[model samples]
Target chain A: MRHPYADLVAHAAHLLAAAGLDGDKPTVVAERLVRADAMGHTTHGLALLPAYLRDIGSGAMTRSGEPAIVVDRPAAVVWDGRRLPGVWLTARAVDLAVARARDYGTCTVVIRRSHHIAALAAYLTAATDAGMMVVVASSDPAAAHVAPYGGKRALFTPDPVAIGIPTEGDPILIDISASITTAGLAARLTTAGRPLPGVWALDGEGRPTDAADVLSTDPRGSLLPIGGIDHGHKGYGLALWIEALTQGLSGWGRADGEAGWGGAVFVQVFDPELFAGGPAFRRQTEWLAENCRANPPIDPEKPVRLPGSKAAAGVARAQAEGLELFPGILEALVPWAERLGVAALDGRA
Target chain B: MRHPYADLVAHAAHLLAAAGLDGDKPTVVAERLVRADAMGHTTHGLALLPAYLRDIGSGAMTRSGEPAIVVDRPAAVVWDGRRLPGVWLTARAVDLAVARARDYGTCTVVIRRSHHIAALAAYLTAATDAGMMVVVASSDPAAAHVAPYGGKRALFTPDPVAIGIPTEGDPILIDISASITTAGLAARLTTAGRPLPGVWALDGEGRPTDAADVLSTDPRGSLLPIGGIDHGHKGYGLALWIEALTQGLSGWGRADGEAGWGGAVFVQVFDPELFAGGPAFRRQTEWLAENCRANPPIDPEKPVRLPGSKAAAGVARAQAEGLELFPGILEALVPWAERLGVAALDGRA
Candidate 1:
C-alpha cells in the first residue's frame, strides 16, 4: 500500500506528540525520519520510531527542553543534548551553523548525548538548499560493534560521516560508514538465517566470514571496517578520526561512561561565497559531476552516476506518487498509534 | 649506509637552492621531504627529489614568487599557489591556519596550483604539537590514476586525507588515500615484475586483478578505491568529497584542464580551548587512545597500536641513530647534485 507523504508525516508527528515530545520537536523529528524514507534509507526511517517510543516511555529520552550550551564561539559551538531527540537537535544545530557560517565563513557545532540522529543523509538537503556545504558525523560511545584494524574485540561503532556539496543542479551528498556493513543489517540478516553477500564480518577467532550469525555467536564476531582484511588499517584510521571529531571534540564519550542509546554528533557548515565566489564553486563542482557521469561504467547497462543522484530521484518519486513503506514498518507502528490514541495513517495511493 | 639527519637536510637544501628555489623555500621543502623519510613514508620522501629537480630544470615549477591571496576572511582563506613548491606552500598554510585559529576558533586555507606536497602525515605534527586538531587533504587535477566506483576509466587521483588529534601521549595521526594503493607503488611493483598482494586494480574491462602490469597495459587498468569491488562506493564518495574540499573550494580543478604535476590542497586547524576546554578535550582523547592500545590483537604476538604509534617510533629511532635512505634514492639524487654543483651527503652514522 502507498501513503501520501504529508499524511504519513502528520500521523507520525501526532503519535510522537502524544507519546511525550513537546513544542516543535514532534514535527521536526517526524519530518526528518520520513525524509530518510523518502531518500530510500528504510532502515533508518520509521523503523526506528518504536525504539524511540520505548526510550521515551522508559524515561531514557528527555522531553520538553532545549539543549544546554556547553561552549559557544564565533566559529565553534558545543551543545549538551541532554538525551533529547537527535533529529530535532541536529536539525536545529544545522540551522544555527548555516546562519553563523554566513558571518564567520564557517561554523561547527558538536552535540553530545543526542538520541540517535536518523540517517545522516536526511539532514544534508537543509544545508544544500541554502547554497552551502556541510559535513556531519556521528558516533555512539555506548555501543561497540566494530573492531580496530587487527584487533579481535569490538571497540567502536559504525562511525558514519556525511558531506553535502552544492552544484548547479542537485547537491552531491556523500554518506558512508567506516565499517563495511552496518550492525542493523547484520542483525536483520541473522534473524532471517541469511549469510552476507560478501565476507564482511570477522569471527571471534579473527577469520573472515560471510555468516551474519557470527555477530551473534558466543564469543561474538565483529563487522569489518570499510577496507576489510587486506587494508582495514585505512578504515580503522577513519573511524578513529570520526570518533575524535564527535566524542573528543564534545568532551564526552566512551571514556566518560555509556549514556544509554544516544549519539555524539559533529556538524560543520561552509559558505562558498566566503571562500571562493559562489559562481566559481558551482562551476567546478558541476563540471566534475558532469565528467563523472560521462565516465564509462564497468557494466554498460548500469551507467555511472553521482553519489546522491539516486536519492534525489527517490525523493522525487516519493513526492509524485506516494511513499511505499518497507514491509513491517507500518504494521509495527499500528500498536504505537493505538496506544497513543492517534489516528492511523490511511494506506491509499 | 646511514647518514646524519642534519647533513642530509643540508645537502638536499643546497641542491634545491642551486636548482632554483629562493630564500627559505629550499629549507622548508628539504625539511618536510626528509621528515617523510623519518616517518617511514619513503615513497613520498627524498625519492621525489629527482623529479622535483627535473621540474625545476624544465621550468615547470616557479622559481620564486609569493602566492596570490584570492580571498581572506576570518575563518576561511584561499590562495593561488602559482605553481610554487607544495611542501613549502602547505607548511606555510598550516602555520597561518594555526595562528588564525587561535583567534577565530577554527581556520581553513585552500591552495590551488601547488606542486606535490611530500606526505600528508609530515604536515600534521606542526598542529598537534600546538595542542590543536588539524585536517589536510589534496587532489591533483592534472593527473588521474584511480577510477570512480562503477567506472572503468580513471577520474580521480589517490586523493589522500590526513587528520591530527592531540592526546596526552603521541597525537593520533591518520594518513590514508581514497584508493586501495597508490600509483607510485603500483609502478614500482610493475617494474620489479611483482604482483600486488591483493586484487587492488581493475583492468580495462573492469575485471579485478592483482597484476600491477595491468596498469601499464594498452587499455590501462585503474587502481581500485579503498573498499575494492563490492564496497567501493564508500571510497568513491570520499574521493569526491576530497576533490570538493581541495579543488572546489579553491575554485580550480580538472575542469580547468591539465596543468602538469600540481595539486590543489586543503588545510584546516581547530583549537581545543575554543570548542571544549583543552583539559576536557585531552582527557577524552587520552582515555580513548589508551583503550584502543589495550584492545586484544588477532595475533597475540602483535598487539594493537594506534595509527601513528609506529611513525612516532620510527621518528625516534631515526633521530637517535641516523636516517636510512631507501635503496637507489641517494644514487638517483647524485646526478642532480652534480648538475646543481651541491655537495653530496656523506653516509656516516
Candidate 2:
C-alpha cells in the first residue's frame, strides 16, 4: 500500500531521533531518505536506517556530531565529516558550496571521514535546484566490496560519482557506481531471495557466483566492475579516479588502510552564470532534453526518455499514488522502530 | 617498425602543413596525435591524417586559425576555436588553465567551434605531469552517433570525459566515452573485417546488428550507451551531462543542432595545493596505486595493474621500440607523405 511522502518522512525522522540522534539532523536525514524512496531508490531509502543505527550504536558513526572545516577558501573547502551522517554533512556542504559558488563562480568541498552517503542524487538535488551544476564523488576507506578489474580481493567499494544539472523540467542527474552492482542491491536481493545476474559477483575462488547472500554478507563475494570482464578497465579506471579524488584530495586513508568505514567525499559546484547566463544554460539543456525525448525509439510503442525523467516521474507518481517500496523495508524497520515507540507508519500510534 | 618520436611528429606536421595549414599550428597537432600513438591509441594517431586533409579541403575544419578568447577571467576562460585544429586550441587551453590554476587554485576552460581533439590524454599529460589534477569533457554539436537509452535515432556522440591525477609514478588517467564504443572504434573495426559484439549497436531499422561496417557508415546504426540495455540509463545520463557541461556551458549547439563536425570542450584544472599540499596528494595516490597493483589477482599469473600503468608502459615501449602503428596507417599516409616530401618513416620512402 502507498503512504504519503510526508508521513514517510515523519516516520523516518521519528525513528532516527529516537535512536539517539540529536539536534535538527534527523529531519534532514529523513527528508533525504524519503526522497530516495520517493524516487524508487528504496535500497538507499529506509533500508539504510538499520545500518545507521548499528553504526551509531557501535560509535562507528556518531549520531550527534558536525563536520569540521579542515581548509576553507573562496574556491575550495575541505570538511572532515567527523563520522556524522553523510546526509547532514552533505546538505550543509551543498549549501556552503552554492553560497561559495555564487561569489567565486565555482567551489569544491573535499570531505574526509565521511559516513555512507546513501544515494548521491539526494545531496545533488539541492545544489541543482539552486541553479548550480554539481559533481560529487565518494569512496569508503574500508568497506571494500568490489575487486579491482582482475583482482580477487576487494580494493574498491563501487566508488560512486554523481553529476546534476539544473533544468527547466526535473533536474537531470547522472549517478553511477563504478561497479556493475552495489553492495546495497546485493543485500536487498539476498533479503528477497534472488540470484544475481550470472556475471555480477565473484565467490571465494574468484569465480562468478549468483548467490546474492554470499555477495552481500561480510567476507562477501566481490562485485565485478561495471563492464564485467572484457571492459572492466573502464569501470576500474573510474573507481580509481573516484578514490583518488575523494581520498587523495581529502588526505583520507587509502581503501586498504586500518581506518576503515566512513571514508572520503569530493564535491565540486559551478555556477552556470560563470560561463553563460543561467537561463541560457537551462535553455540549451532544455533543447537537448527535448531532442533526447523526441528521438524515435527502437520499439515504436515506447517513447524516448531523458536521464532523470524516470526518477522525476517516480517522485511525481509517489506523490500522487504513494511510494511503491521495495518489499521487506517496513518489515525490517518495524522491529527496531518499536523500541522507539514509533508504531504504525499509517500514523495509528 | 620503430621511428623516433621526433621524426613521427615531424612527419605528421609536414602532412598537416601540406594540407594547406598555415603557421606553426601543424607542429602542435602533430605532437598531440603522435602522443596518442605513443600511448597506444593509434586510432587517434597518424590514422587521422586523411580525415584532417578531407576536413581542410572541404573547409569544414580550417587548416590554420587561432583560438580567440570569448570570455576571459582569472578563474575561467572561454575560447572560440575558429575551426582551428582542436589540438592547437586544446593545447592553448591547457596552458592557460594550468597557468590560471596556479593563481586561482582551480580554473575552467570551455571551447566552442572546436575540431576533433584526437585524444584527451595527450592534453591531460602535460597538466598531470605538472602536478595538477585535470578533468575534461567534450561533446560534438551535431555528430550524433549514439542512441538515447530508449531511442533508436542518434541523439548523442561518444561524449567522453577524462580525468588525470598527477602521481609519483604514471599519472592515473581515466578516459571513457558515454557509449560502450566510440565512432572511431566502429570505423576501425569496420575496416578490420570485424563484427561488433552482439549488443553494441542498433541497425538503421533499429534492430540489433553485429556488423561493424553497418554501424560506422552514413545513416549510421546507433550505438548503445555504455551499459547496454539493462542499465543504459547510466550511460545516457553521463552523455546528457557531458552534453550539458560541454555544449550547454560553452554556448555551443546541442548534438541535434546543425553545426556539426566538431563541437565543444570543458576542462578544469585543480592544483592540489589548493586544499592540501601537492606532495601529500602524490603520496596518497602513490600509496593507493601501489595497493591497486598489489591487490590479489584473480588469475595469480597476471598481476593486477593500476589504471594508466599499461598506457604508460606502452609509451615507454613506444619510446624504445616505437609506437605501434595501426597496420594500415603508414600505408594510408605514404602517398600523402610523398606529396608533402616527407618520407623515411622507419627509413622507408
TM-score of every candidate relative to the true structure: 0.99, 0.94
lDDT of 1 by residue, B1-349 (tens): 7777888889899999999999899999998888899898898999999999889888898889899999999889999999899999999999999999899889999999898887999999999999999999999999888888899999899999999999998999999989999888888789889999899999878899998876678798899999999899989999999999998889998888966999999999999888887787888889879888888889889898898888888888877787898888899998888888887777566
Please, what is the whole-model Cα lDDT of each candidate in the order they appear?
A: 0.90, 0.79
Give the residue spans of candidate 2 off by over 4 A. Answer: A216-220, A255-260, A320-324, A335-337, A341-344, A347-349, B18-23, B63-65, B216-219, B338-349
Interface DockQ per candidate: 0.82, 0.61
Clashes of 2: 0
Q: What does candidate 2's lDDT look like per residue over A3-108, in tens digits?
A: 7877888888888888878998889988888888876677888878878877777888778867888888778778888889887887788888889888777888
In terms of TM-score, the best-performing candidate is 1
For model 1 chain B, give the 10-residue run with minimal summed lDDT. B340-349
What TM-score would candidate 1 get against the native? 0.99
lDDT of 2 by residue, B45-158 (tens): 777877886788789887765787877877767788878888778888888888888887788899988988888877788799889988888888868888888887887888
- Model 1: per-residue lDDT, tens digit, A1-349? 8788888889889988999999999999998888889888888988899999889888888888999999898789999999999999999999999999888889999999998998999899899999899999999999888999889988889999989999999999998989998888888789778998799999989889998986689788899999999899999999999998899889888888976999999999998889887787888899889888989999999998898889889888877887998888999999999998988887677
lDDT of 2 at B6: 77
